[model samples]
Target chain A: MKTQSILLKQRPEKTPQNSDFEFKEEEVSTPKSNEVLLKSIYISVDPYLRGRMRDVESYIEPFQLNEPITSAIIAKVEKSEHENFKEGDYVLGHLAWKEYQVAKGENLRKVDPKQANLSAYLGILGMTGLTAYFGLTEIGAPKEGETVLVSGAAGAVGSTVGQIAKIYGCKTIGIAGSDEKIDLIKGKFNYDEGINYKTTDNMKEAISKAATNGIDVYYDNVGGEILDATLQNINRNGRVINCGAISQYNKDETATGPRVEGILIKKSVKMQGFTLQNDFGEKFNEGTKKLAQWLQEGKLNYEETIREGFEKVPQAFIDLFSGENKGKMVVKVAEE
Target chain B: MKTQSILLKQRPEKTPQNSDFEFKEEEVSTPKSNEVLLKSIYISVDPYLRGRMRDVESYIEPFQLNEPITSAIIAKVEKSEHENFKEGDYVLGHLAWKEYQVAKGENLRKVDPKQANLSAYLGILGMTGLTAYFGLTEIGAPKEGETVLVSGAAGAVGSTVGQIAKIYGCKTIGIAGSDEKIDLIKGKFNYDEGINYKTTDNMKEAISKAATNGIDVYYDNVGGEILDATLQNINRNGRVINCGAISQYNKDETATGPRVEGILIKKSVKMQGFTLQNDFGEKFNEGTKKLAQWLQEGKLNYEETIREGFEKVPQAFIDLFSGENKGKMVVKVAEE
Candidate 1:
């Protein structure tokens, strides 16, 4: 049998283009002992992948040239030689951008389609959700009656963060690139206020108006001037959780904005950054259980902008930098 | 009796000059029901005082126009009217830059001169020491074998920070303006390495060479290019303690360096700033007792740049900006 895969063809200088990826067909072999043959159902395309494209040392290893790009994917087990996994079970694994993949059973986590949508395992009940949970609760630590301002509030991790902050009894303010995002976050995600950074002339002034009590926690997803502007309104002992800097991901040079050390000194602010495996590897089961419970209780809501077919995976990733997706960006390859 | 006090004659635009202060003789009044007559012994001149001179809302209120600048001072109770009564008892209080003054008994904490030198109460065994202890252990939290890079390592807080980090079994690298500071930190403060930022053409290169491993903690005292330079070398999960920004205090404009939000995101670093009262108001006694214990165990050593006479208090404060002090900058006003 044959499976189509996307491979990294070239290293991008700035923003990645469709030409940077090459689509090819590869033969799928029978699963070896302790391995499972996965039929890919969905593949996640995240903004953090932009960092993996560069030939630099980062939180994770950079994707090597001419290799099939890999990420979190929801797959069905077509064949299994491992004792832990069965042939008909649905699983989530760090598999390739392909239709069929052979992965070690240990790398595959079984998911229940009955509890939540299988695609959610790629998003709200997965790494994206956990990033929001750990980064906010552990680092940001928003308190009741405090104000939390989340940048990129319409995206996967950000949307979850704003909702969770709301659940924590914080007055949540979201910053997004468009008015649509602002409305979605405010209306559907339960954010108390939303500021459209694209339309707002002065973000600092807008935030000052929205967060009248002053920002006690800043959950940052989009870094650049917005992050810089938010620094102006942070109250004493304010916390800034740096989850991702999507605005600077495609930049040719190292991104720069207003220096923060001076403001940090003045306000006694704490700004921290983290990735999932690095920070929450041990707490994954605990985090996912809580997230699942939140979803089951209908206190949490999630959205996914899914592109159909395996051929569109590369385009889906490139679209992330342009702010094309409302929530988690995923590519659907096959039916369950 | 009349006592000489240095009053703020003018608010400085940049670096404070001698003309900005006016010396006046004020009548020392007898203590009332809960007040005590205080004779100034050792007066602390700190970098944070530079912020108080400006008309800005900071952690502490800005020093009032034409009012005597108040700071940590070791004083002797010349007369007492409270039941807590003590004659010839040395005390520490937020007293003015005056040779003699009256203070409420509630603001005074009696210091035992028999335990350590009365001057030590103003430096290592006092607020300066406590600042280092809490900021380092609580925020910086440098683990064993980690590399700790401290800027302005020859100053009061920086000197103490390097020593405490050394005691924690971390490799300490210090950055200071002159070769004298570099040598002092390396030799006396027991820093593993030292970088003379003023003499070094490329501070990043210098740090790269000295800190063979990436920096795990950055104790920032003189924030400017050095703070910017150190960001490049910070390892993943690094901690940056924003103690002071003496380098930028005299600037006519808000100081700006390379924006740190992006780097902070990439490394998952936590950069935090604090003042003693803002962070450790309730835990001051606990921190000081631990500091005093370290002093008694000979696990900690301290140095002070003592400028003689109350007349030099303003000059001594000005000198802090010019990098004239080796350790804690204090003005010795009276004999023990």
Candidate 2:
């Protein structure tokens, strides 16, 4: 069978342009023993993909030019040679920006479409949801009655972080770039308070107004001035869970370190950064199960801005840098 | 009877000059009910005294001009009107820089001269010892076989920090200003290794060499380039206990923030600063009892650079800024 894939034509300079990615057709081989051939349904576009465009060392390796960008994808198993998976099983795996591909069945997990929408398998029931779960509960250690301030609060991981904080009985405060995003997050996610950082002249005062008791957990998705403002409002013994620094990820040079880090000394604060892959291995199933339960119970809500076609994957990824998406950004390759 | 006292005449512009202090003679009053008259035997001079001189908000209140500079002192009771203390008993309390002080019995804790030298009570058995114990164990959280690095390694808190790291079965590396202090720390305290940071042009290379396994716990006493270098060498999941930033304390303005804090994201490091007073009320007895036991077992060693007379207290305190003294600096006010 023929499969269409988006290959990196050139490495990105600053923000990625659509011309950097080239679409190519390739042959999809028949499934070998314990392998499956998947037809892609949805491809996830995350902010961390920006880090993979650069040559610098990070928790994960950078993507090479002339290779297809790989990410978590929800797909349907068109052919299976594995005992655990059936021919028509819906699965989730690190499927490249391709319409179809042959993958080892062991690398893919079967997704339950009956419990939740299949598209969610690429988002809240997938890596994005797991990232928020471990990053908050383990690193942030949010206690009941604590105030949790999440930057990028309208985005994929940040939205989930705020909802989880609420589930744990914490007062959730969110910071987003646009007033519309802020309103959606505050109104939809039920965040106790929301700040439009782009409109606010004084971030510290805005944070202070939202967090009257002071922030106990700061889930930093944006790590520039917003992080600096959050630091000033952190109470004694506060914890800062740095899941991503999306603000500085695409910059050519290092951004200035936050001036208010001195608060870390005064408040005896702890700042920790982690990748979901490092913390949750086989335990990702545990996260998905709980997230599915929450979704079925109507206790959690998520949104996705879907760009059509596999060829648009690179543009979808680039849109994350421009803050063009409201929630989890995904490229839909095929209809359910 | 008449007693002599030293007072802070003026706040120093830079290094404390002789005119910064004034000596005065005052009448010594008898002890009231539940009070004991103490004749100063040994007065501790520490780095924290510099913060007390400035009129700034801090964990402890700043010292007022024309008032005696006060700190922890080991004294002998000359007369007692308290049921808990007797004449000739040795005690430790916060006493002014004077030959004699009438203090409430509740403020003094009895010290044994037979178990350890009286001067050790000021350094290894007092607040400095407690700072090292709780800061390392509570904040640093050193694990067995992990590499522990301490700056200002020849000073009271740093020396005790290295020794306690050894007790905890960690590979201890000490950083000091001079070769002599490094030699003494390694030879006397039995640290795994010692680095003379003053002589090393490349502190990053020196730290990398000393901490070959990478630093797991960084007990930061001296903050500046040394702190910057230590941050570069910290392993993943490293813990930095910010007990003091002696390098930046004497500066006129806020010291420049560290450039390598970006490493916090890569290494997932946690840097937390604390004053002993914050944890003293709860962990005081536990820390002191452990230190005393270590002292009696000959497991902990302390060095003292003692200057004679109450008149030398200000000079002794000033010497700390210059890093002239080797271990704990103290002034002998009178004979026990």
Candidate 3:
């Protein structure tokens, strides 16, 4: 059978361009022992993948030049030579950006289509949802009556973070790039208020206004001047969870902003950063179960900006920088 | 009897000046029912007190203009009406900048001058010592064989932090303003290596060279270019304890440097700040006991830069900003 894959043609200097990715056609190889052949169904395109394009040290390894780039993908098993997985099984794995590939069955987790759609596993039930869950609960640790502020408010993780914070009995405020996103977060995500960063001239004043009691917990996704502003208005003993830095992901030079040590010392604040697999590997099952329960009980809601086609993976990933997508951005490679 | 006191005459714009303080002479007040008359023996001049001079909200109250400024002081009970304290008893309390003053006996903690020097309570056995102990243990959490880096290495808290890190069996590196300070830290504080930030052209390179295995824990007392350099060289899951920001304490405007959210997110580092009384009120006895035991066991050594005479109090404080003191900067108000 024929297969299609995306390779890192050139490492991105700043924002990713279509030319940085190479599309290739190849023959699909049969599965070896304890391996299963997977056909990509829903391919996740995330802001964090931008970091893998650079040749620098990070929590996760960087993507080597001319190699296939990989991320969280929902795939259907076409052929299985393993005891744990059988034909027609839907599995989730950190697989390559390919239409068909063979992977060890141990690397995949089975997902049920009857409980939720196949695409939900790539969004609300996968790493995106788990990322929001653990980062807010473990690090943010918001108490009742406290105020929680979230950046990238309309994105997948940020939207989920605001909902969870509200469920945990805290007031929620969000910061986004567009007025439309502001409305989406406030109206649909149960956020009490929202700030449009593109229109606001003074973020510190804006944050102070929205967070009347001061922000006790801040879930930061877009890092830069907005982070500085949030730090300025943070209440005493505030917590900041650095889930992602989408705004700085595309910068060529090291971004400069106001120093935070003074503010942290003054307010006795805690600022922490994390990745899901590295920090929460032991609690992943617990996180996934809780998130699934929230969805089933109608306590959770999610949005997906789907780009259909094998050729649109790079474009979908690049659109994250421009804030073109509303929530989780994914590409639909093929029908089941 | 006559006594002298200092008042905060003006809010300083940058570095504090002698004119910012006013000296006044008056008669010492007699003790009331439960009050005791204290004759100041030693006073602690710390970098954090600079924050109090500003008319801004902080962990502690801002100093009132034309009012007596207060700090940690070792005093002898000259007269007492309370049953707990008597004449000649040495007590440690956050007291006003007065040679002789009356205070409620309940606010002071008795310090045995026979166990250690009366002046030792103002340095290694008081807030300065406790700050290093808790900040390093609670936040830094340096493991054995890990590399620990400390800024403001020659100051009271930094020197103590290096000594404690050494006792914890960690590789320690010190960053100070001069080669003399570097020598003091390396020889007396048991620091494995030192970096003269003043002479070093590239601090990131300097840190990378000294900490060949990468800095696992960074105890930050001076926040600025040095902090940014330290963050850049931090290892994965590194810890940063924001004990002080002496470099930024005197700034008129908010300091700006390279944004750290990128490094923190990529490395999943933790950065936190704290004040002793507010964060660790219940742990005071525990920290003090451990610090005292270390001193008694010969595992801890302290240096005091004492300036005698009540008139030199303001100058001694101003000198802290210029890195004039090698270790704990204490003002000797009167003989014990």
- The lDDT values for all models are 0.89, 0.85, 0.92
Please provide, for model 1 over B170-289, each residue's C-alpha lDDT reduced to its tens digit, 9 standing for 90 to 100: 999998888888888888899989988878999889999999998999999977888888888889898999988777888855555676777777888889998788788899889888
**Interface DockQ of candidate 1:** 0.72
How well is each residue in A1-336 modelled by candidate 2, as lDDT tens digits?
Answer: 798888888877778888888989999899899988899998888887877777766667888988988988999988889988987799989878889998998888888889777878777877888888888998788999999999999998889999999999999999999989989899889899999998999999999999999999999887877877787788877888887777777665545553333456556677777767765666877887888888878878998898998777888888898789977899888987
> Could you tell me the TM-score of candidate 3?
0.98
lDDT, candidate 3, residue A225?
Answer: 85
DockQ of 3: 0.86
For candidate 3, the docking band is high
Stretches off by above 4 angstroms in model 3 are none
The local distance difference test score of model 3 is: 0.92
Q: Model 2, stretches more than 4 Å misplaced? A: A8-13, A252-254, A258-262, A280-290, B6-28, B54-56, B252-254, B258-261
lDDT of 3 by residue, A207-263 (tens): 999988999999999988889889989999999999888888888656788889998
Look at candidate 1 and tell me the lDDT of residue A146. 96
Error of 3 at B31 (Å): 1.3
Candidate 2 chain B weakest lDDT stretch, 10 residues: B253-262
Winning candidate number (DockQ): 3
lDDT of 1 by residue, A1-336 (tens): 998889999998888999999998989888999999999998999888888899988888999999999999999999999999898899988888888888899888899899888999999999999999999999998899999999989999989999999889999999988988988998889999999988999988999999999999999998788888898898999999988888888885555566677788899999998877887799998999989899989989998999998888888898998899999999888998
Candidate 1, pairs of clashing residues? none
